[model samples]
Target: MEDEIITDGKYRYIEIGEGKPIIILHGLMGGLSNFQGVTHFFPTKGYQVLVPELPIYDMPMLKTTVKNFAKFLEEFIAHKGLKDVILLGNSLGGHIGLLHTKLFPEKIKALVITGSSGLYESAMGDGYPKRGDYEFIKKKAQDVFYDPKVATKEIVDEVFATVNDRMKLVKTLAIAKSAIRHNMAKDLPNMQTPTCIIWGKQDNVTPPNVAEEFHELLPDSELFWIDKCGHAPMMEHPEQFNQILDAWLVKRGF
Candidate 1:
């Protein structure tokens, strides 16, 4: 098969399917291809999927800030002339989704944020330091797993590989520096579109209470907590994720 491309001078996207657009955003260490498994299900469900690697991940973007990154998305969508896309984002992507909706509510149909990052103040937890390095992320990722025994060597290696990836780490640090300074709690109440939030009940990365707090703030939002899963609930529990996604889609007339 030949590779297809969606380019607009400065950026490009690889997309698939045909129907109402469902744009998926990957997290800090993720790329557009990360959505392949999840997007596979959407195509069958009749969703024209567009997974754009955010500017920080997209090779062309250099020295990007949160504001410019948001603009990059707007430009990408405008370049493609897409409208009424359902925005589905995970982790860092979720922060972008929220920012995008705030900037152009008319362009998106709905929002689904899973294990989202970038909305809380940086603070020390009960027994942990406020800021930890790779060790912290690794430990936290492990704790998110429902069964600690299931946090296999493979998973640990993958997580370590992700943080240690050169480009991925740069993106992570740069975005951390310029992202709307977290605290989206104040903005949630203003969101007009219906939103569905999914989180792993065992997610130490972003606790269930945090997801619930988002739901409470968003006037029109629902929460689904997948059991026996962790930070990456979509991957850890795809079946439950799909069921919740479809039900939310049906409920919202998407």
Candidate 2:
């Protein structure tokens, strides 16, 4: 079945399949297009997936703070009349998911974070790639994958399309700066929800060590490391990600 975009008020999202609901959150790039490759996999397994296009990219005034994103998620859940959600968040989306779970534990059943941000500050500097700097965007895309060659032309084009707008560039920088100041290390121990942490062994963005630190922090969490993968495992290695995710879900009795 094809993914369909459904609008609830001003919120736009892709909702697919039925049964237990799984909401997949996108990272700083801020759209569902990059995640389409993996989002469709859940429906066939009898799980519904919702990918919301968060409004952070245009709301520069909010600075894309974790707190605000968490609040947005709360409103999202309430507006959609959703309950017992499993948040599969990647990068910034993961950061938001972690925060949301902490703030609204009753609304979520389990959490899955992949190369998620918010645990630690990124060393990639505080600025977004300059508009029209194709090479810079290309390099950033390459870093997201362990094998740089997989950073295809289409991927490069997608990156270009996201950060090319001046407004988007500004919002990206603000979000990056906010992310740098984010540190959920102190709060992880307090998160009691069943959580799964997935990371790329060679992830240059959120390095493997950071994943280990998260494992140490979350008392009831399990960590999985994927070899030859970088930041975005669901995109870089979907089959392996799917296998691990399916097993984890069943083990958790989802």
Candidate 3:
């Protein structure tokens, strides 16, 4: 995935297949490779999949807000000359997609969010007192998934590195605060974009109830659940996640 990324001016992304675009938004600590299942599966199924590298840490401290990330997405969409595209996001990425849709509804065709943090604040970047402790960091990473094994050594190392970095750590905390400040509960009902909410039944990060609340708040939303899955349904249960999203897109004629 790293080798496949195309660097065009200020935007760096992965574009595959050729059809209706499905722009993927990676979460705060998530990388483009996290959506390997999506990038590979969707392209073969007649949809162009794109995973943009969000400037989560590159922005100035004051600009490190979810709203600015939404604006950046709009710029990326316009740069690519895309229209009526589907936006699929997870965690912080999901929050950005929601804000983007609310701000720029004309171009989005549909939205898919999993383990998103709009109503309920996530525990990301919390309890970092033991940032220097490898075992502690490893355990924290494992907590994101129902199956602790999903948090591989590489994943743990990546998270450890991010939290240990001074700049990235500060920006991460800033984004977390921005997520809380920009809660979408009051704005969900007014935004009528068709949404597909696929959640893990055992997600401990955002929890299961958040999905139900999203379904209740969003005017046009359908929720699906994957058993034994955690915050990252796509990573933990990619097959189920893809299947549910595929069926929803077909049913809604997207």
Candidate 4:
């Protein structure tokens, strides 16, 4: 079945199936569509999966900030009348999730972060690439995948499309700078929520070392490393990702 789109004035999302709420937040170059691979399966497993298209995805004119996104999530939960939300975030989305958890721990039941940013400073350069630079965008995309072919021209084109506008490029750069400057390592030890930290063993972006740091710091968290996977195990190795997620859920007695 097709997922239904929902909106509460400021945000737009897709709601699927029924039962517990599991919100999936996408990375810097993602939208609700980014979760296509796993969105359908969750509902069948008795979950109300919500994939939101954040403002940063569509409105590049809006300056993206961790604090702002946290506020947005606060309003989003209240608008949906959701409680005990399980947040599954990747990359920038993961950063936002961490910020939200720090600000409003009472709203979350658990957190699942994959190849997440914010635990350590980003290695990406100071500013966004020039608009319409396909080669640059393609190279960056390839860096995230263990297999270069998975980067695909179409994917690169999509990124190019988003960053083609100068205004969007500015916003993207602002967010990138903010990402590198933001650090939540000190706050992790204080987080009381149950957490699962998943990372690609071969991740060049955040690296496995950062994942280990997270596992060490989060008092109530576990880390699962996927070998041979790059920055995006969910996309590069969906089967393994699903298996690990299932096991985590089982352990939680969900």
Count: clashes, candidate 1: 0
Candidate 3 segments whose C-alpha is farther than 4 A from its true place: 1-3
Alpha carbon lDDT at 124, candidate 2:
58
- C-alpha RMSD values across all candidates: 4.3, 2.0, 1.2, 2.2
Ranking by lDDT: 3, 2, 4, 1
Q: Best by TM-score, which number?
A: 3
Clashing pairs in 1: none
Candidate 2 lDDT over residue span 1-254, tens digit each = 44567877889999888988999998886357667666878888889888988888646466467778888889998988899899999998998999899888999999999998887746354454667889988888787789998788887887798787777666777777777676788889998999999899999888888899989999899999899998888888988898899899988899
Give the poorly placed runs of model 4, Cα more than 4 Å off. Answer: 1-4, 57-63, 121-123, 126-128
Q: By lDDT, is 1 or 2 better?
A: 2
Sort every candidate by TM-score, greatest first: 3, 2, 4, 1
CA-RMSD of model 1? 4.3
Which lDDT tens digits does candidate 1 get at residues 1-254?
Answer: 33365775776677888998988877665545545567778878888888776767554435555656667778878888999889888877788888888888999899999888756522122443213255665575457556665555665556577566776656656676666464577788899888999998877777778898888888999998898887667766777888899889987799
Quote model 4's TM-score. Answer: 0.92
lDDT of prediction 2: 0.84
For all candidates, the clash counts are 0, 0, 0, 0
TM for every model, in the order presented, reads 0.80, 0.92, 0.97, 0.92
